[model samples]
Target: MVEISIVISLILIFDSYLLGKCISKYFNWNADYFPIITIGFFVILGIFEFFVFAFVKFQFSVYYILFVQYILLIIPIFVAIKVKVNLIPTQKELKMILGGALFTIIFAFLMGNQTLGEAAFDSNFYLSMVIENSTSPTLGTINGYTGNIENISTLHGYQGFYYFHSLLLKNIRNILSLNNTSLTPVYLWTSALTYFYMLSDILFHSINLFLEKKSLHTKIVALFFVLVFFTNYFNISFPFYGNTWKTLNIACNMLILYEFIKLNNKKSLFLLTFLNSSLIGFSSSGFFIACFIEISFFFYLIWKKEQNYTIYLEYWISCLSLLIFALLYFSGNYTKISILILAIYCLAGYTVYLTKRFDAIFWKKLLQFFKFIFLISVLLLVIVSYFVRNSMFSGSDSQFNGYSFFFRLNSLGDMTLNYFIPVNKIEFVRNCVFWFIIFINCFQGKYEKEYKFFLLLIIILFVNPFVTPFVVKYMTSIVYSRCFEIFINPFCLLIFYTGLIEWLEKNKNIEILFLLALEIGSIGIIVHNNISYYSKFFIPQKGYNPVYRVTNDQWELYQNLIEELQSSKLERPLILNQDIAVKAYVSNIRVLIDANTSRSAPAYSDENIDAPSDWLNIFYVRDYYGQHIWKQDPDYSKICDAIIDSNCDYVIMDKEVVVLKGDLYLPLWFDARGCSEVIYDNDRYVLLRVRK
Candidate 1:
């Protein structure tokens, strides 16, 4: 497996290099920056893969994707090999890269090997999608509860957004000849490492640009930036956060923002536009960030009086193309409508550009003004309507609720302080004094514009948590307070680092002390957090603890159940409780349901359940497990009929059911329904064979 993982990594690196070389030639970037460029190109390639498999209707196979990818690499490889370019990094840069990679590997290894966290379910869902897509030709959900392939379009529009990571893992699994369970750790490690590389490269470039230096010290500072943001400690204990596709989105947007700020050439502009549009295919958060950045750039150009109408034209064109692509790729009517509204916004911007270019009579100008006003009004209405619709219909979770505005505000403060300064009182005081010095220095007017921009970003980050409650109230079902941590924490660190660097340049004597203190404090926090995280798994008493870490016994039990199911050769779909669904999905078996829904499993109701009719009925049966048997209820009869009609061939109940729902309900319900045959039983789990 190790050998195969290395081979797969090499393939990705080679492909990234070839694509990066082509982009470098077009953009006139230095060859030493190939690795950084390669990270961006890798994301571009993943987007291309998604488009081919989804809209282009290409077969969803690893070989097909790679064959095409490699074929496309030939031209760039040939061109790059023939050209004389200084592709080698400086010694200092090499050391930084190696050090960052080593640190990332060690951290990812620890994270992957430790017990599961909140993101484990999401990781499993992504893995299952990869397995299904790789084994089957079609791109759709496997209906984990029913084994039926449902069009992914109807389920969720962003299905293709996450396929990038899934495809990578699928390739790894295919090459390693490993099962999904074994590949879980590898997926975590690879995804985290890739994110670290991309982030480190971005920081290296940004810091080098800012300091006008690329020494060993600068490299160390770059690593410091990476460690500061990428650690689980800074990110609110989200160890498996790397498994989500949003990480890729964040990296791409940050890099795109940097490129937009630095480069203004046509080729670079085109690439930036392409990157902006590509975010639409990744995640909605990316789309939001891209829109914000693009709009901000448009205004910046206007403010700078650049008079580059062509840039404006490219921006509008890209916006329109993104809208059309979203319409084609995304199934939700609201999503498509949102894209159309954004297109109208682009249209309004174009009209404003035209008004500035071509002189018009009073009546014509008046007419254009009214048209723009009408467009703006419509845009506002569309946005408000969507928000209202979501608020009215979306399901809520108790865990996400109860976060008061003040509490969230306070949490942000602690997160920001801990992110930069040490948690102890003395270190915190020292950091605050240093921060005041940096603040005074920043006002001295060197890089005034840059400081202003950073200040604006800091303000936005600080206020975002306060705004999240209202956003969740009016626009989304899930709480995005966690998302604020993922997106804002990096900028908070960057802003502080920028200020610190400026201060360090003036106060050389304090530089070494600050760096030393930072290293020690950062490492200490990471070690402490990791120890706390892993210690939960070793606690003696456990009966469905809220912080449910996967135990070795439970893992073995799940494996045994999979083996039994395989031996049974059951044709019908298997039903698995939400808690064990992740492991069950790893078996690559067709399931009636796996826990990928928006709401908590126990809180599921008829209106919010995302499953087949029959499977949903069975879900309700198990969901209300010990609650007074609703055998007399119509819904209960529906569940019994579904079970008796062969909707599910098997059911796996974990020990949590007995603890939470009691054992009496399962037996009584089965006997009353007269449809289930007990096949396997133990203290930890139970398996039932549903009869036709």
Candidate 2:
């Protein structure tokens, strides 16, 4: 907990403020938003490094990433010193930091113990990727599940957050002298803190946006309202456990919304474009969200009649270049989506060109026509994707069900209902009823144009399958619920908070009573429903918790296994261990087979074949390595023969299984077929040296 506090403070204070200050010079943003902008900058920098590593083909190490972060850190420090800029946080900034930290601590306490949900889920792979990045020279190019060379561009393009995780994990290990035994807890805590910081920053900035002069009381009140109504009420606990990439995605989208609302100059536009690029590599549906935000921002600019064609051209061109890079370097449906977004930005640039050159009503009409075409194109894409969802995702059927026109329609309807239906725990505030009041308030109150824009976005993109089909899988995917909870829920709260603040301002006499009642009520509900219902949302996670993913015993086994593997004579010795908990820590070693495949197959065997070509290798390997399936203990000679046949240098097995007789154990195999020497033994696991 102390370490978590230190890391969070270091990030919020130094990395966020200083590094943010340096980048803000280039991007030009308010100093108040430096924390989020710094985070956004890191997201972009991390992605840039991801591409650099993938395209340039270099041996990667923790030092490489550390060097990059140090460079970023030094630049800001140098600038602040040279310019004599004050580096200390102001009293107001200190309050924001303390407030955010308090919320984070509360969140951590609520989300107690966690575990990796399933073996085949993306979280397992993401864990492996981070470990690989931390220790292996292959960086993210090698697949942890299969010891095969995988192009990072294909599978890991949108997962740049892994690089960030790798960076933090390495720093923690180096700073604290912790080993793989401490990795899981540290990783979990760091990830949750990072998300909380991003979220808190969003809330703080949002409050200021609404209130003209935000006092400490007002800020705290607004934060409490959002933390309860938006964060606690929404079932966003999945990200805190292991799906941290989604949390980052949600944070990035919130930052995008913030920038979109405050976008008045070229700096905000540049930030938005950079954020869009980062989203392209964030997650599976990252680009879908990016496109939704981009199109809305584009239209917002046009509607405001703030068409500085040159600035718009610069922004579109910047997006165009990044989109083309993503298209060329990456594969899958996202690339296809990128082509569409790329074309839209390109066409938008051309239209801006024509509108600037001709300055005619005709060109303006053409721009309007292009907008309609874009909408129609998006609708057609969704319809086509729906029809071919089964074929396109034949292997990955777990992500989406077999396609039916009626099923798609039913899914959309269900999503609409889910958006308005509050969770069972917080039934007092039905989302539908809350939204109804807010919708009426939008017409009743005097608000900024951008506030209405946010409202419009919630109505259109919150449950619109056609708009977010790629990310939401036509509102049928398991991620659909969590996505909206993080994606649309915050914006809704912002609007609601704005209206509430205005109403409170008009009736100052009852301000304290209203806030006190709401705060007390929200806290009461949270305490009543302390147990998270995230697991029951859509997919049944076999072993899901909100905190530490690996158990103490499992972590001890990992440390022991790693110690033995490190002492081996062979360079990159191949060891075979089927313990699922050991998967996150063994990325540096060459494993004969994936532990995730052996451990998680029973639970997620149906969903294992998400992609035919991709998962067939895993299934084939699992068939041969029947450690879990084959119940009988084989002869010592047979076990030795199996190890040698598989070309594995070492094998770690349970102490109970490697017995020569009932109570006897063999030091070395003495058989004609093959031989193995007992190199290391523990109460739980036995490590054997397989000889050729």
Candidate 3:
């Protein structure tokens, strides 16, 4: 498995280098900045996968996709070879790369070795889908609980967004000839490591761009700050166990920012559009973040009076093209109409420019005002239409109830504020002092442009939650707001540090000593927090029990359960507790209940009610809240009879279920129906065979 992972890593690096060189040439960027280009390459690759799955309507397969990629690369590879781009790195660059690699490996090892015993259902649910799709080659795989093929693409919205990660895992599986269960750790580690490495590379490059005179010591310090901030600050809210997609999207956003800062021509427009659209393939929040940033940049350009007609033409063309592609592939009516409106807007803008109407002072001012209004109005309409179409702001009686709305808003507010002032006391004080330095230097006018841009981002994120109640009805406000923070917080920190270093360059020795002391103290706080959190896994800490640790007995018990189920040869759906579904799916067996029921399970027969005899619903609710309402219900016998008459061929009860449902009721209910036989019994679990 390790050898297979190394091979996959090599393939990824080679492909990224080739594709990066081609993209850098197209955009007229220096070939030395191929690492940034590599980030763009992955973004484009994900978008390509989405298009293939969307239009082709076939199951995702690594071999077929790679074949297409290689064929398409022939032209670029030929051009690159003719150009003879230098792919080697200088000593300094190589050292930075190696340093980033070492950090990523250590982080990935920690993340992978952690037990999955307490992993979030969301994480396991996506992993199960990836594993299932690999074997079957279809996104519409049968639901573990209901045995129905679901159109998960439309239901989840993020199904195609993370396909690239799934593709990598599938490739690893094929190369190693390993089963899904054995490769679970590899999947977790590889995905986390790759994303972090890309993020580290982007951060390093962005910092270098900000500070043109890069030094070895400065580079190492910057890398340390980036690693510490991300691992500590982000982990407070977004942990590595369940939020892998979020982490990847955040990194992609930073990559977009790097590109935006360097925008020069039509090629840059294309690259931005491609990268933004790729976010839509990953997560809805990511897509929105991309759109927001693109629109903001558009406004900034117009505000600055960048009268390059070609740039405007390229911008509008990319927007129109991207929306049209989104409409065709994703089948969103909003995207369809967005293209039409954008076309009209672009035409009007072009008319003003072509006619030289902006030559006169009054006319120029008036036209600028009108342009601002037009752009802002169009953006507002798009946002409003999204909420309306999704019924997010329906009514008080809707799922967007008062409690949920308030709770979401509060959570968003807390999270946004926490990003600036961390929850930990020492870190909070250090962050406060750091921000104080930035605030005091805000009036110096040295970084006015950066201040304006990032300040606008900060304001939007801070205000989003407060206004969300009026705009979107049913959506989780925190989720939407957190997306912005995830994308913006890292950039904010980068900008702050960049400004600090610039200040230190000009300031006196005493001022430099004071600032250096503050920064070092901040770094120390972050490192302490990380060490404290990570240490709980090995050495137990008071009031901080590690979630990702399982005992030897529990591991052995689950291994036995998996082995028995695999050899059962049962032809009917196995009824399992919801908690056990992850194990079942990893073992490549079908179960009757799992966490992925939002789109998979059958719809309710009546509104506000579920059938009492529905095994899926019973176990779903039980596992969801860890409560056994089924056993205590007055209609328990009837529900048991219904399940007995259904197609359920086996029932597996773990210790939790046995404790909740009790030995007497479970055994008597099945025995009385004369359809169940005790097959296996142990202290940790019980297995029953249902007669056909």
Local distance difference test scores for all models: 0.48, 0.52, 0.50
lDDT of 1 by residue, 272-335 (tens): 5555444554444444445445554554454344445566666665454345444554435577
RMSD list, candidates in order: 7.7, 6.9, 6.7
Q: Between the candidate structures 2 and 3, which one is better when assessed by TM-score?
A: 3
lDDT of 3 by residue, 207-229 (tens): 66555485555554565565555
Report the candidate with higher lDDT, 2 versus 3. Answer: 2
| TM-score: model 1 vs. ground truth | 0.69
TM-scores for all candidates? 0.69, 0.73, 0.74
Model 2 Cα lDDT, one tens digit per residue, 129-158: 676666554355767565455665543533
- As a whole number from 0 to 100, the lDDT of residue 491 in candidate 3 is 48
Q: Tell me which residue pairs clash in candidate 1.
A: 144-591, 144-592, 144-593, 145-591, 145-592, 145-593, 146-592
Worst 10 residues of 1 by lDDT: 410-419
- Per-prediction tally of clashes: 7, 3, 7
Clashing pairs in 2: 158-281, 395-610, 396-610
What is the clash tally of candidate 2?
3
